[model samples]
Target: MLGTICRFWRDQRGIALILVTIMLPAIIGFALLAIDMSRANNLHNDVQKGADAFAIAAAAELDGAPDAWTRAERAMENLVDNTTRFSNSGLVTLASAGSVTVNPGASSCRSRGNISWCFLKSLPASDSSPITSSNYATTQAETLFVQVTVTPESFSSIFPASFLGGSNGLTVGATAVAGSPGAVVCDMVPVFICNPFPGQSLYEVANSGQFYKKSLKLVVGSTSWGPGNFGFLRPSDGHGYGETDLATDIAIGRVPECVSARRIYTQTGNLTTKVKAAFNTRFDIYANGGGFPSKSDPRWPPAPNVRKGFQYASNGNGQGSGSQNPCNMELATDATRYHQLTRDTSFTGQIGNGGWDYTGYAAANQMTSALTHFGSSYNNTTNPPSRYDLYHWENTHDSNGNVVPVGDPNSLVHTQSVGGETGVPACASTVGDEDRRLIYAAVVDCSDSYVQSQLNGQSGAPPAIGFASLFLTEAVTGDEVMAEIVDIAGSRGRGTMENFVRDDVQLYR
Candidate 1:
């Protein structure tokens, strides 16, 4: 049969040669078609990956995911004809009207389904798991698990099939599930204290909420006087001096304790206090809550009689002040509010571990020993207390295994160390302890505090470089409020992975 077809083609006498010639190329062409198909398959696979990445990114709210998908879709949208929705540039542009259509799982968890997809929500402030993490639900019941599905119809390379038929596009699908490592919920942030110093101890016993010192008329400086043991605690779980340090006075070294000491919060001459009940109602949405700030909770106005922040505080541009201004308290934004978050209820009843400044007390004791350094009259009791610099300290466990040492800010010497308090067992060891400085610590509750005999006792001391005061921002649920002590030198503080410490720390005995 093969010879008959070839013989007729050479003779050119029969129509068989023309049919044979045509069929010959057709057969060869079909084989080439298979080869091209293989190439197209490879292209299809590459495009699929791009499509998958794009789909997942679009489904989530990653920083630039939407725009990224736009550029990618532009590169491949035309290959599959104009019918590809995934390849639609309109859904990923500056004016994108795209919304993720979540096909909920059987139990409301998208993870249960085959097609899942997603993206990360912009910084969530709650102690909840990130929407992107797989263990989001395990961390908190508030976490919703959902599978995302996307159809990037533009990924198909239909043009290659034009030889056989015409363009016929393809569609791709993908999904993702959110989760967390463990249930987390600690919202009690202790930002301010009766005595604000880098290194000092406090006889801390309660896990009471931290008080507002600067915002109100309260104490900020720690004293190196008074009697009684002291205790200490920090939000990061770092332990410190947990001994009696005078009733409420902190000291750098031994000294004739003050006749009476206090932390000032107790003398409520003229301090401000908003009803927690009223403030708690901030979560309640107003009846007309439909502008840019969407409301997720129930609606209720300030009950007329309940009262809100001073009047309707307006925080214009956050440059000015408003009692209820969203700009001022951005930390409480509805989407991923960080302020109200606290550790899980399971751990709420507990206290926080305290930390100490290794060099604080060491330097204080050393200063007390000298009475005067480089020629100066040290008198911590009343007038001229010699100025000194306290710098450097290493972790040394206190009697209670509290690894904290109180030291003055900078290397400024304490008046007792430089003026008076000279001899004490702790002082002797601290003075000679070359690697560290002395520290003073004390504890006071809501209204307990002590101050320098004069607000500016040792004026010569260098100012605390950064924020001299601390204020605790209430924790919210669902996401974490990233706290970093990013000093110019990059000093790493205690309490977390890499570089995050709770803004406020609670302690339990």
Candidate 2:
């Protein structure tokens, strides 16, 4: 019995070595797996971060795209480009790797009265598609939560595929989102830099208008404000409140103290030849009591004054009430009228044997209250270049630095009377030059579907408002972006996508 026990003990001794040998390999395998798995997890985290960064860049670009598909497409290209750009920033700038793209659609003219940013990223394939998660089906969302990803492929810590096989590469992703209670202010500023002023139409915007729907504007002098009675408003945005008080106000609100509009003198000179000649020939003349007692010219339209020229014409929005485009029409026929002629030595330089071939000018002999204030102007030596160049700052000042009125009617100016003198009417449009004060107003060419309705409460309602309203103005550009992505997984993993972290958390629109 003792011998047998001894042999058993010896066998037990070898049992320890055997167990060690067997368990060691298993332990080693597990250890290797844990090490590799940890590495992969770390890499995945890195990729997720990279993806988040790229995705945001893509979405931002898409937001400016003209259409949904375009936004998606641009998102893809932008993501790739951002990758390169960030990569170029050096390895330190971007600590990891992953890709991003957007799936888009479902939102349009969001500011027209909608919530959510217009274009946002969607998913793997198309910009946007039906998606379901957390026992809930997402019917439609303007934008998707952000997508961030991590791929073992970007993991340098792992060498070869290890025991897992294939290539040591793996991919993971996560998505995130940011919300912007965007105001129209985003797209309208670059269009017009307004100049703020104390008086006139532009100053009224902070007081009214739907610019919050599109943008904001500043006023005159806020741009260039010495002495001028008018400022116009409207963006080629069709915010058509030209000369309307609100229009001018909104424009100034947009960009105050802006020196000028983005301008290029592409077209030189005045109105078209046909229009000019027509104005000259049909020019009307009236005799105030100062010139003749109770003599009126039936050929002319109702004259606000006996010896002055203010032109009026039909505005073809032919469908609306009082759809008249009014202006002080200066006719070439009135070029040689008595009280209006440039006579400064510089006049020779200004007219160069030529003259402003436009409407009548008179006022020197009219009584204080006779018919209306009629006044003539001469080439101002105070501001030589502008003597014949139409109204400008220099011409607005007197040789004595007083606020000088348009002496003799040079260019046709809209006007009203105060003292014995008549003040010029407000301008009816934004300077239309990038370097000038930007004006913004909502105006349709009269053919707008809801023209009457949309402008119901607007100033200058044909005749009801009694006068054209004014507002600030500016210019804006149009832009579009699109993308598609794909994902494939075999089995036994959590969604296998860091980019689509489905149910762990609720997603935002």
lDDT of 1: 0.25
* TM-score per candidate: 0.26, 0.27
**Full-model lDDT for every candidate:** 0.25, 0.27
lDDT of 2: 0.27
Instruction: Point out where model 2 deviates above 4 Å.
Output: 1-50, 61-66, 78-172, 178-183, 186-439, 442-509
Give a tens-digit lDDT track for model 1, residues 448-493.
Answer: 2313222222221111111111211121121211111111101221
Give stretches of model 1 more than 4 Å off: 1-146, 155-159, 162-167, 178-410, 413-419, 422-498, 501-509
